[model samples]
Every structure is written in C-alpha cells, then in structure tokens.
Target: MRIKTTRQQHILRIKTTLRWLLYYLLIFLSFIIMTSGTLYKPILLVPLAIAISINNNIYGSAVTGAFCGFLIDICCGKLFGYNAVILAFFCILTNLVFELYLKNRFINYLMITAVVSYIQCWLDYKFYYQIWDYENVGRIFVRVSLRVWAYTVISAFFMYLLVKLVNKLLMPKEHLTIEEAINTNIQNENKR
Candidate 1:
C-alpha cells in the first residue's frame, strides 16, 4: 500500500509537470503569433494571463503571468520587467479575488479580464506614449491603445474556453465507481 501510494504520487507529479509545460508552450506560441507583424496586435497576453489566473492557484497564476509578461517585454522590445511585474501582480490579485470574492463564471471572467486589460492598456499608453510627449499621442491612443483594449476583451472569451478545456483535460481521474469500490474492498478482505 505504501509503495502503491508513492507510485501514484510520483505519477501525479509527472502529470502536473507535463500539464504546466503544455500550458507554457501554448502561451509561448500565442506570443509568437500575436507579435507576427499584425497591423494592430491585441495585447493577447493580458486575457491569456487572466484566464490562466482564474484556473490556477495563486503561485501558479503568478508564475504564468510573469512568464507571459517576460515574453511580452521581449517581443515589444521594451525595457525588461515592466510587464513582468505588472502581470504577476495582477495575476496574484486575480487569483485571490476569484478564490475569495468572485464566482468563477464566464461573465465574471470577462468582466475581470476587461478591467485588467483596460488598466494594462492605459498604463502602457501613459508610460510609453503620453509621458514621452510623442507627437500625435492622442491619435496613437485612440488608434492603438483603445483598439488593443477592445480586442483583448473580446479575445478573453476564447482564452477562457481554452484554459477551461485544458484544465478539464488535465484533471485527475481518481474517483472510483461504487461497483469498483466494492470490488476493491472485497479483494482487500480476501487478502486479509
């Protein structure tokens, strides 16, 4: 029994590691696609991060967010760690809020994704464009930032579905049916 339990634990750990690796691969591919010379690319990572946060624990969410943000910074050619810090912070907050206060519903996820995406877009615009006093900053804000926010929010629906599917697929199938349980109990009694 002890050996069986240990084996099961080791298998569970391997499964968990594989699941996270798949998630990271998905996010990395998403970043590549999002940054592939689109005319107006959405901040795809925001909704993705938020979706991940909703599905994961606080530590998982934070790590995923930081990973996504680090990719964003690299792709955007911005200073390192800006998006990393912001995304990690928001992901942690999202996990806590959802765990405590908010129900994990589709509508709630969309609302939270919208709010967080909006804040991220606004911060990006304010720091990169507005503060720099670039010419036609208002035009850029309207044309770029607002559009990014809208697209990010719209993409949240898909991201939420995708993450939920992944979670479902990775969930452990540990429960035994009544018949199976009874059979197992009988076998144990016979052995005793």
Candidate 2:
C-alpha cells in the first residue's frame, strides 16, 4: 500500500510584502555566512548551492545563489557579476531538474548540484578567465573541476546535516510543503 503524503502548512508565506523583506534578509545573511569564511578554499560554491536547494523553494534557491555569487565577487574582487550570472543559471537548472526529473530526492540533489557547480567552474575558468595559459589548463582542471566533484560529493552529506540543523533551529511550527502552497493559493483565490 502506498503511504499517503500530507502537505505541511506554513504560517509564513510570500503572500505578504514584508515576507519579501524577510527573504532578502535571510538571503543576505546566508550569503555572508557562506562567503565570509575560508572553509577549504577549493569548494566554496557547492555547499552554498546545497543550502539553497534543500528547501526546494525558488525564492530560497534564487536568493542563495544570487547572494553567494555576489559575495564571491566581492571577496575575490575580480570580474564583477560573473558569479551572479552563473549562480542564476544554476538556479534555473536546479529548478528544471527538480520539476522534471528528480522531485526532491537526495541523489537528485547531489547530482544536480555537482553537475551545475562543475560546469560553472569550468566555464568560469575557460571563457571568463584567460589567466591560465594552455599548459595550465590541465592543472586548473585538476585543481578546480576535480576538486569541485570531490567537494560536492563529500559536501552532500554535510549538506544533509545542515538541512537537519536548519530544520531544528529555524523551522516554523507550521511550514508549507509544495502541495500546501498550491492548494492554499487555490482555496484563497476561490474565496475571492
């Protein structure tokens, strides 16, 4: 017998304008935290991506990506807007994969994030950066791409832990599951 899955209800909703301000604040804080410290030095982006992807909310995903990328830009003090553009792209890719293929499975999260993060780094090096010469390509690949895979793969578990931690700390008494959000909107509209 298939078990019935019920949607969780949210006390907070994007239903309000103030909620958007909350989103911005959360995004800004998350971005600062993700960018502030030097974790391992090689794999900063993956965990940040995971942090955003876990909630499976578009607002969270976009905000996390946008802020993380901006932080990188600010810290690296290099090409402006590069990280932002790439992260936004990752947001779209993650959303597409979630909607079409994965449906919020753990493996899907790992695979999507790993794939997107790797591609972003590779492109960042290849097109946006010519700092490295032809001979350095192999070295860069080993350092950046390979490291990213390792980072994402290893970071996946920690990401899970982080989600659980967030759930414990910041979780609401009632929060909207994807279904609840849709149904709530539908019902609210019918009343109007």
What is the C-alpha local distance difference test score of each model?
0.84, 0.60
Question: What is candidate 2's lDDT per residue for 1-192, written digit by digit as tens?
Answer: 122234222233322334344445544554555456653343455555655555556776776677667776775564788887778768766766676666656677767767766776677677745564676577666765577557656765665565545554555454455667788789999999
Write down the worst ten-residue block by lDDT for model 1: 1-10
Candidate 2: give the clashing pairs: 9-175
Task: Give per-residue CA lDDT, model 1, range 45-141, as digits (tens).
Answer: 8888988888678999999999889988988877799999999999999999999999889998888889988888889889999998988899988
What TM-score number comes out for model 2? 0.61
Residue pairs of candidate 1 with colliding backbone atoms: none
Q: How well does candidate 1 score on lDDT at residue 167?
A: 75
Sliding window of 10 residues with minimal summed lDDT for model 2: 1-10
| Candidate 1 structure lDDT | 0.84
Off by over 4 Å in 2: 1-40, 128-135, 168-192
